[model samples]
Target: MESPPSVEIISSSFIKPKFISEEANKPVYLSPWDLAMMSTHYIQKGLLYALPKTQDFSITAFLDDLKHSLSDTLTHFYPLAARLSTVKQQNPPSFTMFIDPNNSPGARFIHSSVNLTIAGILTPTDVPITVQSFFDHHKAISHDGTKLSLLSVQVTELIDGIFIGCSVNHMVADGSSFWHFFNSWSEVFRSGTITRPPVTKRWVPPGPDPIITLPFASGDEVIERPNYPLGLRVRIFHFSSDSLAKLKAKVNSECNTSKISTLQALAALVWRCMTRARRLLPEQETTCGMAADNRKRLSPPLPETYFGTSLHSVKATTTAGKLLHHSNAWAAWRLHQSVVNHDDKVVQEFVNSWLEKPLVYTMSRYFDASCVHIGSSPRFDMYGNKFNLGNGLAVLSGYANKFDGKVTVYPGRESGGSMDLEICMLSKNMKAFESDEEFMSVVTY
Candidate 1:
């Protein structure tokens, strides 16, 4: 086995917004949806780009440009450059995210270099464990927002490429907002401006009270620091557009339903395959949860630029026997129904229930060996984030919030309907899944 690359940190500093206004300094109230994510891990993701061919390429100049663009970008997305404040002395403990211009709580900017090539990191079947080092705040959860920076960016220079890793508090932003900020940063880097300015005003669901407070007396009571599991393997599986279309066609034809989407079909396929690989008892129950964006599901749908955490986990469950005995179309139909049923009414009910009693998303609440939870979306324009460098070679997730059944979906670098599944599972189950003929047949990796 090859030795892991050594990463040396050259500098660690905070990048504040270039400018701030009175309106920008106002405290942003946390909604029930935001509070629910307090215990979850930060969203750690990054882009890898090959180095430019010019001989005059200067690392110092490139780093300077990145910092300046980030500072300018934070002017619009000011919340990211701020900190989460908690007041335990209040009646119910007031929790709000505030930007203190005097304190200037800026986002952490880290510059580092690795002694390895990009191929050394990407060519392997399993993502190198060291890749997690490319990100910051590995031990910090969203609840730590009271003191920690809400967002952290680490730029690690490679032998012939660079990796820009970003870690954002999950309570402050979901995958949509994470990518929105990333795309905006890249736009600022290339043109010194953004085409679609972010809508920083958070959306509040209709309820008796717009601001919801948690039942806890202090933020520390809700903080959870769970040790990451061991003996888990992570691998990326590529499914080409043709393969995806064929899978979708097969399932739709079998069920005589044209409403099953490619993503639904793919999720069903993974759920069934993982169940089979686990060799669970026939009578045992299995669940598949997919993160659904609620922006469009509301009555007065939120704007595309509505920037905050708006994701709800829509789940489908069935007996292991039924999932395996039934055809792929059957499973796909189940998943399709779960997503379809999560409409405006269901979204409202969820928000109301959450408002009545706010609950933080601890690891135990959502993860299990018998369940598979899918996060992120393939619809994100990942490859389009070209910060003067050419298009990205790959997109990767970090070690935070990952477990045996976590699966993250990303658009393939080629980007014509191709999809990549970053799957994490127990070593034994991963071995079985790799050997499964049906699953391997469609995997282009």
Candidate 2:
């Protein structure tokens, strides 16, 4: 990433906004029905790299400039500064809140230091190994506010390679919204003003009245825990377009189906892989859930411009006997039906139930479950544009999902004419699928 020229910060007119208070705003209670989707752990972060155009590039200079521009832009987004709050004992409704540093809603922390290392520059490395890391590495979940570590700035070059790594927090934004924010940020830096305004449409989380009955009793009912280490492994698979087409053809032929998006196909393929991985002694079934953004499904479709946490979830389950022997197309067709039926109310209802559950209780159920999976759409324009920082553009966001012992799928490169799909599963699951010649053929294709 090319560093920007230094500019004077004379006559600063910066003023940070304060988070909303219970005294000022009404407390919205969570219901039990909202729990299905809300019980999972949610942590998002991103690593954006500005690939180099020329071998000659400077890291320190580029990051210093990016920080200046970013800080200025973030000053306008107040949610980053706000803290989380829930209703206390419901009489007239009072908020029970603990302003934890990690849970703060608004711009909680900024990158405090910069760490840089270059690897595989002159080596026989075939692909760029973007080893992006985060700051405030050690964060403990606390009820009370605690000072947290911040990644003030990070800029690194890989030996003779050209790329700068940038990572950011999830509370600030999701992948799609953050990408929009970054595009605007880049536009502002280049044009001195954003060409497009941010999406400001309000997302009505499950309404406050009727007290959405969540599945759980209270927040105390849901359990939250860090993901198990080494239990899950992450890998990226790129399929040749021809192979993708052949697989799609096979799926269509086997299922007597029409064109199905690669995502739906992969979901079916993954479900089969995981269920078959169990090497079961008896027939069993498991649920597979997909994260659907209902921003466009509301009575009034949510503003594409509206920014906030706007998402709904849908789940599908397959009996071990059915998935184990089902043709790829058959499972894919069933999976597609389940996802299409997921709507805003379903999502909101799930969230309500999630919020009402005791954290511990929810966590335990999640950990004990044999089948659970959730992932987002790869709909954003990530690898399309080249962001030139006198070097190259890099992608960034907060989806550090370690799919521990679960089946997960996200968007990948295009397969056929549809969006390509990225599928992740536990290592054991991967091995199991690979062991099945037929299953492996379906996936590898």
lDDT of all predictions? 0.87, 0.45
> 1-445, model 2: which lDDT tens digit per residue?
7432221211212222333433323322222322232333333333334345565755555554555555555544433333434435555433333222234333433322222322332122111223323322222222111232112223333333333233333322444565566566565555546555555323434454534332333444443544544544444444455655677677777777676666667667766666667564336767666667666766667677654445544667767787777687887777778777776566556555545552322334543335656565656654432335432222322223444444333334342333333334556665665577655564443
- Writing each residue's lDDT as its tens digit, candidate 1 over 1-445 gives 7668778999999999998878777878776778888888889999999998899988899999999999999999998998887644467554544333345459999999998888888898999898888999986788887788999999999999999999999888999999999999999999999888888787777567655666767766766775578898999999999999999999999999899999999999899999999999999999999999998998899888878899899999999999999988899999999999999999989887887777778887667789999889999989989988898988987879888888999998888899999999999899998898888888888
Query: How much is the lDDT of residue 352 in candidate 2?
Result: 51
The reply for model 2, stretches above 4 Å from the true place, is: 1-42, 45-56, 85-132, 135-172, 200-202, 205-223, 253-259, 344-363, 367-369, 372-374, 384-386, 389-400, 405-426, 434-436, 439-445
TM match of model 1 to true structure: 0.97
Q: What TM-score do all the candidates reach, one by one?
A: 0.97, 0.69
Error of 2 at 192 (Å): 3.9
Local error of candidate 1 at 230, Å? 0.5
